[model samples]
Target: MVLLYDWSDKHKEGVTLMNSPVHASDLPDNQFDIGIVGAGMVGSALACGLARANYRVVVFDRQRPPPFDPQSQPGIRVSALSLASQKMLADYGAWQYIEAMRRCPYRRLAVWEKSAPRLPLPKLGGHRGTLFNCKDIHTPELGSIVENNLTHLALHKAMESLPGITSMCPANLEDLNFSPDTATLTLTQHPPVTMKLVIGADGALSQVRKWANIDFSSDQYEQQAMVITVEYAGKQQDITWQEFTPTGPLAFLPLPDVAGKHYASLVWYNTADNIDRLMKLGESQLIGQIWQHYPDCLPAVTGIVDRGRFPLIKRHAQTYFSKRAVLVGDAAHTINPLAGQGVNLGFQDVMALVAILSRDGKPLADPGEAVHLRRYESERRPLNGQMMLAMDLFYHAFSNNHTPLKLLRYLGLNLADKLPFAKQQVLQYATGIKSPPRWLFR
Candidate 1:
């Protein structure tokens, strides 16, 4: 069942909804209020969120998403869910479905430089790295770790009963036409559908972004991420941590135990050459590497379940909107995965866009009006830019063996550990619960 809040009407609102396809002939002149291209987590969430607000939403995806299975081995593609994202999912009724499946909640986060933990320098703060505990901040958990496919499937299921949404899977976008009042989308399966707005929630290589003529800047790093899933037997942990080595950061993300077996998702970021060599290693050899390099808190890799590799890249559209369309998620920006903030940033974008479009609960003169789209762009661009820059700084400082930079970063991290209030603010920003200081964006 689906419930809605009527913004135009000042009173509390509740309404049950059903999902059905709105054919091209069902609407006046075959026009939908909104046409979203991409049914991944970001796109599906936007469709549901907008549909709940009474907007006629249409979503298209090239392939149908596979069903999420709890009985299967963990997938290599997973995401770190922040507190703000968790609240959004719960509000949108997606969290229950995700929680009903397999998920892991982590309460603590620790980050440290690999070589500086033992250096005793009082003038430069303590030797150990900074640790942020949820208990210290009065929260039950910092975030949850979930499989990427599961998140997409959960959001897709949530859209089932949303009244104003229509979706076509195994449908690919062929072309797009933009005008002042409406955008026309030509798809492979259905007749061309016209709509007031088009959303590009597609992945890094966004066709919607390309067709919209929205210029973008992309940065490809020399580093690559090697991901692996492993089964283990040990005491369960509620904390996730990353240790910065000369190559890159090697991190452990906790996963829920199944049938008395503990599991975790491992992320090893390093140069493409090194990642290639590591990827070629057999299960036992890779386990040996992990056991030798990782911190003592993690469990031994008893068995390997899955492995994958991806290159690191940073990209941001020069403009988020063009004519009657706007971009969302990786279409608008892609950041380094050093902190796993990519998807969380995308979810935050949906939140901000929904807030602007649903202002006063009254329908806008035109949902895709330049003014409204610009408003969404104005607020999100600077914030994403700030995070991108910060991550870049971390990458350069830690990836290199430069003596001065390594020392500076270690000292700064150690100092942050000592400063409670400041560290809290940083944690809040990192977890998407709050914005960073405005000056940082500037």
Candidate 2:
């Protein structure tokens, strides 16, 4: 029988339960209630949530996050966390750690199309772009920009503090087998563990999904993205902006000040070969290239700290669950990063799954029951699919040079800029303050 504790009222109090040693004679025949693969942001966050509800959770990851250093330069991998995501972290007690470490919050967001040859159309004075302000939506700030490593570390710390969670790091899943009532996971460095439910929080190339025999479809985008961490010659700014070109988008995201110096993360989207050429350039050469090609509004870049590149791909599993196994986060779906909703969608998955398993603060007797897993899939799959479609639309529309589509783009941005209701709705949706209605999913 699964062990359950009523943690609803005492969740704020830190709890501790030592994990059983690999060869401990007292170890239960079935040690864990839930087995989670991948302990990154999504997986760790899920572990924290379930543990808070007093579920015996075991998490497996191949590697551990490096210890954070206050003096180190920001990592090239960063994410813009929407308000909804922040709330989820705060609820799990991880946001406090993130705030104590480092984060940069932006109150405004701007997007515009770069100037190019235009067909005869009404020209708007100044830049034809939509600027979204937090005040417009009655929110204090839009979202916070955080280093991916810091977020992972914060969630990892929170997971460690929860008594109900057992973390197995440097442990690789050697094999997975599902019986009638439970799933067994064989790890390279640890004894096999059994659980009533197994979840795949692994990334796009999910081993759990593969082991479960779940099929997914993926499409590679024509453009690749290169991210550069740099210091700017000014104070920290409260805004993030993106300029769209026929090739791809040029985006600037503010990072927290380091040693009283302002820093920002820049993203340049282009063809794979072009990104490779940019990546090969020296620091000074790349800085010069930024000044030559980027929009005039970009601040003077003083020095480059680090840079990396990734190919864009959209993937979705054909189904979220197979038998006793289920998928979440990137294991379920991945969208174009044009809108920065990838992780927020993952957090949403965590919330929905947790809510289903721990209904009304009462842990289910069998968390892996097919009916409960189906409900979790039913709640998240459509929303993820919808967001994927929306990102695809933006990716295609902004990356095209068609004259007619260009005019439409200009008009859409202009209308979004001028219309109060439309702008507010768009802002709320983008910031994750609002979600699409159920009727739209019909």
Ten consecutive residues with minimal summed lDDT in candidate 1?
2-11
| Cα lDDT, all candidates | 0.83, 0.87
Model 1 C-alpha lDDT per residue in residues 1-442, reported as the tens digit of each score: 2211112122123322212233435443457898888879999888878887788888877644567666787777999999999888887778888999888999999999888734445765544689999976688999999998888888978887677777766465689998778999986535688999999999899999999999999999988898989897778878889999988899999988877788999899988888888889998998898888888777867998998998888999999999998999999999999998999999999999988888665456578998999999999998998889989998988888777786688788889998999898888877777877788788
How many times do residue backbones clash in model 1? 1
Best by lDDT: 2
lDDT of 1 at 235: 82
lDDT string for model 2 (1-442, tens) is 1222222223235433222234344345546799999989999999989988778898877666777789988888999999999999999989999999899999999999996446676765565899999999999999999999999999988886788777766465789999989999986535788999999999899999999999999999999999999999966799999999888999999999977888999999999999989999999999999998899888899999999998999999999999889999999998899988889999999999999999677678899899999999999999999889988899999988888888899888877888889899888888878886677666
Model 1 CA lDDT for position 200: 94
Where in model 1 is the C-alpha error above 4 Å? 1-29, 117-120, 123-127
Candidate 2 lDDT trough over 10 residues, lowest sum: 1-10
